[model samples]
Target: MAELLEQRSSISLQLIDALLEVFGEFNQLNIWSKVTKDDFTVKRFDLGNDSNLCCCQLTETAKSKLNFSSPKDCEGVVVKFLTFGDNGITDNGLSLADIVAVNTVLSINQISPKLLFANSKCYVHEYIKSRIYTFENDDNPEVVKCLARILAKFHSLDAPISNNAYKTSQKSYEDFFNRRKHIYGWGNTEATGQKYLKALENHPEIKEQYYDEFAKIDYHSEIVYVQNLKERLDSPIVFAHSDFNRGNRLVVKDSKDQLEKIYLIDFDATSMNNRGVDFGDYFSNYRHREDFANEGFPSDEDMALFLNEYREKCAQIFGTEFLDKKENSLEHMIDEAKIYTLGSYIGGTFFGLMWYQEAHDTGKGQYFLNVAKNQSRGYNRLKKRFIEDGTIPRILQMPK
Candidate 1:
C-alpha cells in the first residue's frame, strides 16, 4: 500500500510538471509554482477522511499539510489533479464553454465547484469554501432535500451561452449494456451488435427481454394520450449531472444549522440529458450507498417528500405556474426513473456475478456473489412495490 501511494505521488508530480508546460503565463500570474522542487508541493487530499476518490492538491508554495479546520483553511487558487487512466484526458482540456456553464451555476448558490483552470490532463478550481463536516457524505434528510433543491435551482437558471442541451448518456447506457453483456459472456461477440442480443442462460428475462418493453418508451417523439391533462411529456431536457453520487454532493451549513451551500464536484460526467437521468441516479444509485442508512431505495412517501420539496423550490424560482408542466410530466418522469433504476440494478448485479464466476477475480468473489444476490433481492422487492403501488403501468399493458 505504501509503494502504491508512493507511485501515485510520483505520477502526480510528473503530471504537475507536465501541466506546468500548459499553465505557462498563468502559473506565475496565479502565483502557482511551475517546478515540483522545494517551491511546489503536492499532497493527497483527504476528502471526507476517506480515500475512495483519489484527489490531490497542488500548491504554489511549500505547504505539506492543508489545514481543514475551517473553510478559511482552503484559500486562494486551488489546483486539483483528477486522472482516469488514459480515456479521460484529451488533447484539449475542459472546453471553455463547459467551464462557463459550470461557473454560471456556481454563481447562483454554489451548485458546483468553480472551474478556474482547465487543460488536457485535469481541471483546476477555486477551493470550495466548506469545513470537513460540510463535505462529508451525509444522509441527513435536510442535506438530501438541500441537494435536491440545489439541483432544481441549477435547472431553473437561464442557460449560459455555451450551455445548450446535448444527449450522450443514452448512448452510454447502451454501451454499458454492451460491456456488461460481453463481460457476462451472454451477448454477441461482435464489436457493435452486443446491445441487440437477448437473454442469459441462467437469467432468461434479463438484458433485451427485460428491457424491450421499456426501450419502446419514447418521451419526445412518440406521445400517446394515456390520460387527459396528465399526458406523459418529454419535459425539456437540461444540463444533467451524469454522476450525482453521494461523494459528489458536498454541503456547507451555518452555525444556526441552516444549509448555507452545497457544492457539486466532479463534473467529469456532466452532460445534457432529461432531468429523469438525475432523478433516476439519486433514487436508485446514490440512495444505495452505505451512508444512506435512512432508506435503501427511499420509500414512496420519502420520495414524494423529495419531489414536493423540489417542486416547492422550483416554484420559488420558476413561478407557481411553472410547476404545472412539471406536474404533468411527473408520471413520465417516474416511469423513466423506474426503467433506469431497474436496468442499472440488474446490470450491476449481473456484472458482479459474471466477474466473480467467469473472470476468476476470486479475491472478492464471495462478497460480490453475495452482492449480486442482495441486489437481485432488492430489485425484486422494488419491482413488486412498483407493481403493487401502480407507480408504473402493467408490464405488457403499456405501449410496445
Candidate 2:
C-alpha cells in the first residue's frame, strides 16, 4: 500500500505540473476564480480505453456557487493528458482533431462539454454531471430514440473534416492488428507474444476459426465493397462519430421534464463517412461487457423504432422530404444499417483481440478472453445471417 500511494502521489504531482503549465501560476486566463496549489483534487476518470489515454477529473475542494445536481453546474474539469510514446512526438494531431470535432458538435447546437483550456501536454474540459450510458441495465426504448435523434443531428452536420470515414474506419481496423503484432506478438519476436499465445493455446479454435479466417481477407477491400454499395444506394456522406459506442455516450436527467438528455463525448475518430457506419458502430455495441449478453444487440423491431425517429428527425432538421424519396426510404436506410453491421462485427473481432491483449497484460485471467470469444462468435453469427439473406458474398471478395 505504501508503494501504491507513493506512485499515486507521483502521478498527482505530474498532473499538477501539467495543469500549472497549461494554466500559469496565477491562472491568468481565469479558467477558475482562484487557482491555489491545493485547491483542487485529482482523480482519474474511469472511462474509455485507458491503455493509451489518461482522463482525470479535477474537482475544486472549495465551496461552489451552484447546486451540485443542476445540469448547468460545472464544479470541475476533465483533463485528457497527452501520452508521449518512445518517439519524442506527442499525439497532438489527434488531440487537435478531437478539439475540432468538439467545436463542430457544439456548432450544431448539440451538447458537448465546454472546453476550458488546451495545450500540448493536456486539454481541459468543463466537467458536466453525467453517467456513462449502459445499454443493459438502462433498457429504456426512449433512450434509444433520443440516441437516434442525437446521432441524426450529428450526421446532418456538414462539418469541415476529412471525408475519408470509410478509409479511416478500415485503417483503424488494420492498426489494431498491427498493434497486436508487437503488443500481443502477432508476428514478432517479443516475449509478450509468447505469453499471449500460451494463454490461448487451449483455445485452438479461436485461431483456426476466427483469427486465421479473419486474417485471410484485407479489410480495405471490404470497406471498398460497402463504399460502392452505399454510393449505388445513395447513402449520404455526413459527419460521423466513428467510435459512437455506448461508453462514449453520456446521460443526464432533465430536472424539469425528467426526461434523459443525451450528451456525446469523445471525437478522436470523427470524420465524414456514410451515415450507416455510425449506425453500425452504435448498434454493434449493444451487448454488456461483463456477461457478454447476446440480447443487447438491438432486434429488428428496435432498429425500426430507432431508425424511424432518426428519419423523421432528419426530415425536421433539414426541412426536406429527407429519406422519404422512392430510392432512399426508411426501409432502405434500415437495410443499409444492417449491411454496415457486418463491418461493425468485423471491427468487434479486432476489438476482442485488443481486449485479450489488455487482459493478458493486466493479469485479468480469462475475463477478457471470454469477451474475445463472444465477439468472434457474434461476428460469425451476423455474417452467417447476412450470407443466407444474400446480403453479401460468402467470402468478402477483394474489390477489383
Candidate 3:
C-alpha cells in the first residue's frame, strides 16, 4: 500500500510538471513556486482543494509566450488545469476544448481573431472584449450579427464519428438528454412531477408552492401530446453548442453603439444536436421567460431580421440550403426551442435535487436546492405559457 501511494504521488507530480512544460514557466520559477513565493499572501488560499479536479492559472510571464501585447484594460491570460479521477468522465475537457475551437473559428471568421490553446491537463482561451450577460439588453447590431454568424458556423462543423479519439459521438444531443434522464431515474410527466414532490418534501418552505402547481399536472394527457410531437421532428442533426447561453458569449462595442465583436466561451457542454436546442439555451439562459413574455420574446421583427442575416451569411459560407425547409422552418424552430426549454428545466431540476441531497449531507445543500426550486418554478411558468400559447399542443401533434 505504501509503495502504491508513493507511485500515485509521483504520477501526480509528473502530471503537474507536464502541464507546466506545456504552459511554459512563470518568471524564472515554476507555476507552483511562483504562486507561493509570498508565503503570507499564499497561506490564505487553499489552492490545493479549490476544485475536485486539479486546476491552476497560468502566470502573466507564462502568457507572454503567446506574444500578444497587454491591453491597458486587459487581464493576463489565464490557463486552467484540470484532471479527472479514475471513476470520473474523461471526455469533459476534450468536449469543452472542441466548443472553444469551434467558437473561436466562427468568431475569427466573422468578427476578429481570437485564440484558444489546450493541452492534456488544461485549456486556455482569450477574448479581446468584455463578456456579455444578457442578449436582450445588448442592442449592438454587430454583436447580434456575430452571434448569428457563430451559430451558423457552429452548425457547419463536422459531426463526430464513432471512431474519433475525442468521443464526439457520445456527445450527441439525444445521448446527452437520454443519459440525463437515466442518471436522474425520472421519465415523462408523472415521474418528473413525483420527483419535484420529493424535492419539495425536503424543502417545504422553498418548494411547496411550486410542487403544488406541478402536482396538478395531468401526466397521462401529456403522453399523447409528447408522442404525437415526436413524429413531426425530422430535422437533420448538426453540430451544436449544447449550452450556448449568453454567459458563454462575449461582446465588444464601438463608440457609435455598434457591436464590433462577439466571443463565445465555455464550450464544456457542446454537442451535436438540433438547432432548436441551441436557440432554446440562448433564450432561457439570457432572456428569462418572464422577461420575454412581458417584453415579447426577441420580437418578431428581431427574429425576422436576425434569421434573414443568419441565413444569408450561412448560405455564403456553407450553402443556400444551410437553413433549408422554407415553408415551416420558423415554426419548426420555435417548437424545437420549446422542447429544449422544457428539457433544460427537467434536467436542471434533477441535478439540483441530487446536489441538494449531497449538500444536505455536507450542511451546504439548502442554497443549491433553493436555486433548483426557483428554476423549477421558472420552467413551470414557461411550460404553462407554451400550453396556453398553443406551442405545447403543436409539439404534441408531432409524430413519435
Candidate 4:
C-alpha cells in the first residue's frame, strides 16, 4: 500500500510539472511575487465531472505564507488546468483560443474575467467572488435588459484572433451537424448516437415521440435554407459570445454598480457568426433547465424590452446611418432573429443531449437526468412551435 501511494504521488508531481512546463517555471508568471509552485497549495474546485478542464482555487495557505494584509490585497487566483488528448496534443487549441478571445474582449472594454497568465496547457485568473444568474431565479426585467446591452456590445467587436478563425452560421452548423450525425438517425455508426440511445433506453417514449420525430427533419437542408434567408435579410455577422448561457453570465457580488456587476466568462465558443444567432440564443435561454411543462419562452413584452435595448445599443455603436439600412433596420433584424431562433432550438436540443449523455456516463443521479431532460424538452417545444406555425417559411418569404 505504501509503495502504491508513493507511485500515485509521483504521478501527480509529474503531472503538475508537465502543467507548469508550458510556462517554463512558476516564477516566470510574474504574478507569483518571487515564489514557486511548491510555495502554495491549491484545492480543486468542484465545478463538475463533465468539464474538459479542472479548476483549483488558491487556498489561504498561500495568503498566510505570503503574509498578505487582506484578501483584497492579494485577491488570490484560480488556476485552470486544461486537458490534452491521449496523443499529447491539446484539444484543438482550446487554451490558445481562450487567450485570443480574452485579449479581444478586453480590448473592447468588455466585462470578462481578467486572465493573469495563460499558455497552451494551463492558465491562471483572478478569482471572482460572484454569483450566477439563472432564468428561473434572477429573471428580473431590468436584469434582462442589462444582459441585452451587454450582448449588443459583445457582438459589436471586430478583433483579430489567433488564426482569423471566423466562420459563418452555415459553416459552423455543418461542422456541428456532421459531428452529431446520430441525431439524424445515423446513430448506428456514430459513437455519440450509441451513447445517446444507451442513455435514453429507460425512457422509450422520449425516443418514439420526440427524438424520432425530430430526427425526421432534414436539419442540414433546413440550416442551408436559413442561411440563404439570412443573406437575403442582410443579417450582419459579428463576433458572437456563442454560448451566452446563464453560467457564463456572472454577477459580481462586490460591485454595486449595476452596469459593472455582470461579467461574461468562458470564451471557448467565441467566434464570428450571425448576430441573430446570439440574440436568438439569449432569448431561448429563458426556459433552460426549468420545468419544461410549466415554463415558457420569455413573454413578447420581455422580448421587446430586451430587443429595444439591443437595438438602441447597436445604434449607439454603429450609428444610425448603418442601422437605417434595409438589412440593418430594427424590423428586418427582428425578422432575421426569428429565423435564427429555429437554429438556436436545434443547438439547445444537442446541448441537452450531450449533457444527458455525460450524466449517464458519469452515473449521475435522477435529478441530473431530469435537469438534462428539461433542457431538451424546453427547446423541443420551441422547435415544435416553429414547425407547426410555419414561422421560418413565413419569415423567409417576407420582404427583405
Candidate 5:
C-alpha cells in the first residue's frame, strides 16, 4: 500500500504541475478538497473564490505526456489552458475519432456545455464551462426524464459506421475498462475470480452464482457469440452514452427547485451500438442487492413514467412509435434484458468482485469499492433469477 500511495502521490504532483502550467500563477488552481467517483479521478478545488465561488471541474487523465491544443475563446472568453491527450496516453487514451463522436453527439443532443470547439488544434481536456448543479437524489424525476429523453433522441439517430477511426476510437475506450478488470482481477479470470470468491466466503448465494456463470463462459467463444449477435441484430444502430449510470449526468436546478437543463458528462465510453446496450446500462441498478447509485433502481411507476416520457419524445423526434408497439412486444424487452444482463454481469463482476479490493487497497475508499461491490451483487442476484429463471423482478416488470 505504501508503494501504491507513493505512485498516486507522484501522479497527483504531476497533475498539479500541469494545472499550474495551464492556469498560470495568478489564478492558480488550488486543491481545496478531493471527492471520489466510482470510476474516475476527480478533485474539487477553489478557483480563486474568497467567498467560495463556483467550482471548476479540471478532470482529465494528466498522468502521461500531456500536450496542448492551440487555445481558443468561447463566447469571447479565452480559456487559459486547454490540453489534449495527443499522444500522451500509452495504454489508454482518447482517439481523434472519439473526439469527433463526442462532438457529434453534443451537437445532436443540442446540449451543452456543448463541445466548445471540437478537434480544436489539439485541445485535450474538456471542461463544463459553467457551474454544474447537483441532483437532490439519484432518482431525481427531472434527471430520469432528461436521461430518457436524451437517450430516445440519441437512439433515433444513425450510428457510426465501422470505419477504421470508429474501431480505433471505440477500442481505446473499451480497453480502458479492460485494463482495470485485468489488473484488478490480477490479470485473469481465475485469479480475479479467486479474489472475489475470497471476498464472498461469507455469502454463499453469490458464490454459487459466480461459479455457475464463470463455469459457463468460454470467454473467447461466449463473448464472440454475444458480439456476433450485436453485429447480426436487425435493430438500428443508435448513439449511446455507454456509461449512463450515476455521476455521469449532472444538472442545474431552477429557482423553483426543478431541474432546468441537464448534461451528461464523461464521454469516454460513448459509442454507437444497439439501443439495448444503452438501455441495459441505463437500468443497471434495477436488479437486487443494495447501494445503487440511484434510489434502489426505478420502481414500476418510475419505469412507466420514463418509458411514457421516452415514447412521447421518440414520437416527437423520430415520428416512430418505440415502446408502445403492437402486442407491446415483451420479447424485445426480454431480448434486451438478456443482452444487457450478460454484459453487465461480466463487466460488473470485473468491477464489483475483482476491482473492489484493488481500489480499496489502493486507497480509493468505500465509494469505488461499493460501486464495484454492489453492482456485482445486484447483477448477480438479477442474473440468476431474472435472466436465468425468467422471474420479473419489480424493477423489470412493464406497465400493463
Candidate 6:
C-alpha cells in the first residue's frame, strides 16, 4: 500500500511537470516550483485543493485553449493534477470554446450533468456550486429553460459525427450500457435494496406503506420486464449523452435574475440511444417533488415551446425535417418520452438499490443511498402513472 501510494505521488508529480513543459514550449505559461505535493482534495469549482499552481498560462494559450480571445489577460494560470482510484482522466485541459461546445450539445440534446472540460489526456470542469438540498427554490426552472434554448442552438450546429471515432462502432449501445453497469455495479441496486429493506424492516410502522409497495415487487420479474421492453421499442437511435441530470449542467445566472446560460459537461457516459432517453432526463430532472406521487413531473408550459424551438434549431443544422413532422411527430415523441422515462427509472433505480448497502457499509458518502431512494420513489410514481393511463398494457401488447 505504501509503495503504491508513493508511486502514484511520483506519477502525479511527473504529470504536472509534463503539463508545465508543454505549456511553456507553447509560450503559454511558466511552471513554478512545486508549492504543494499532497493528496489532491477534489473540490466542486476548482481542482483538488492540493493541486500545484504555476503562473497562469500566456494570454494567447489560455485564449487558444479556451477558444476565446480576451482583450485583457490578468492573473496567473493554475494547473490542477488529479488521480482517480480507478477511473483515469477522460478529458483533460480544455479551452472555453470546447466547454461551450460540450454544453451546447447537451442543451440541444437536453442532456444535463456536470460540465467537464477535457483535452486528449486530461479533464477539467467547473467546481460544483454547493450541495443541492431543495430544488423548489433553486434556480432550476430558469436553468432548464436556458438549457433548452442553448440545446436548441447547439443542435443547430452541423453534426460533428465525423470528428468522433465511436460514431461507427458496431456494439456501441451494448458497450455503453455494459460500461455503465460496471461503473455502477451491483452495489447500486441489490445492495442498496437490502440496506433500505433492512431500514424499513427496522422502522416498519413509520415506513409501512413504502415497505408494502416494495415488498410486492419481484426483482427478477422487474429485470425480465426491462429486458423485454428493450427488445420491443422501435425508436430510432441517435448519439445521446447518456448520464443527463441536473448535476451535469452548469447554470449561469444573468444580472436580470434569470438563467443566462447553461453548459453541459461530462461525456464519459456518452452513447447512441433513443432520443426519448434525453427527454426522460429532462422530465426526470425538472419534475416537481410534490408531483412525484401523482407521476405528474413539472415542466413549464414553455417546455413544448422549448421543444419546438429546439426542433427549429435542429432543422436549421440537420436539415428542414431533422425531427419528425411537428404535429403527429410531437405526439409520437411524447409517447416515446413516457416509455423512456419508465425505462430510465427502472434501470437507474435498480442500480441504485444494488449499490446502496455497500456504500452505507463502507461509509462512502450517502450519495448512492440518496440516489437509490429518490429513484425508487420515481419508479413507483412512473409505474403507477403507466398503469393508470393504460400505457403499461399497451406497451406489453406492442410487437417486439
Q: Pick the candidate with the highest lDDT.
A: 2
Residue pair clashes in candidate 3: 225-396, 228-398, 229-398, 230-399, 231-399, 231-400, 232-399
Highest-TM-score candidate: 2
Q: How close is every model to the real structure, measured as TM-score?
A: 0.66, 0.74, 0.65, 0.73, 0.57, 0.59
lDDT of each: 0.50, 0.59, 0.50, 0.57, 0.46, 0.47
Residue-level lDDT of model 4, residues 208-316, one tens digit each, is 5445433444445655665676666666778777666666677754346453467787665566666776766666656456422225665445667778888888899
Model 1 per-residue lDDT tens digits across residues 1-400: 0111333445455555554654453544343434333444344444432332333344534344422233433333445444443543212223445644555556445676655565544456665546432223335677767777877876666555332224334444345445655663334434234332222223443433333332332211111121211123343566667556556665566889677877777665565656665776567654444422213565655666566677778789777886677332445556656645654455445555554455333456445555555655555666677767775454335443
Q: Which digits, one per residue and each the tens of the lDDT, describe model 5 over residues 290-397?
A: 324422444445556565666678778755655466322345544454556555554664454344455434554345545544555554555555544554343245
Q: Which runs in model 1 stand beyond 4 Å of their true positions?
A: 1-13, 22-29, 33-36, 45-109, 129-139, 158-166, 179-184, 187-236, 254-258, 285-295, 326-339, 350-359, 362-371, 394-400
Ranking by TM-score: 2, 4, 1, 3, 6, 5
Per-residue alpha-carbon lDDT of candidate 3 for residues 101-145, written as tens digits (9 for 90 to 100): 554554455432243455545654332435354645445555566
lDDT of 1: 0.50
Backbone clashes in candidate 6 total: 41
Residue 117 Cα positional deviation in candidate 2, in Å, after optimal superposition: 2.4
- Please provide, for model 6 over 193-261, each residue's C-alpha lDDT reduced to its tens digit, 9 standing for 90 to 100: 433466545444535545555545454456556556545656555555555555555555566755444
Instruction: Report clashes for each candidate as comma-separated counts.
Output: 1, 0, 7, 0, 4, 41
Better of 5 and 6 by lDDT: 6
| Model 2 per-residue lDDT tens digits across residues 165-202 | 45645466456556665465554434333435555555
Residue 227 lDDT, candidate 3, scale 0-100: 31
Give RMSD (Å) of candidate 1 vs. truth.
Answer: 8.1
- Identify the runs in model 2 with alpha carbons over 4 angstroms from their true place: 1-10, 25-33, 51-61, 64-73, 83-98, 136-138, 163-167, 174-199, 202-234, 254-257, 287-293, 354-362, 393-400
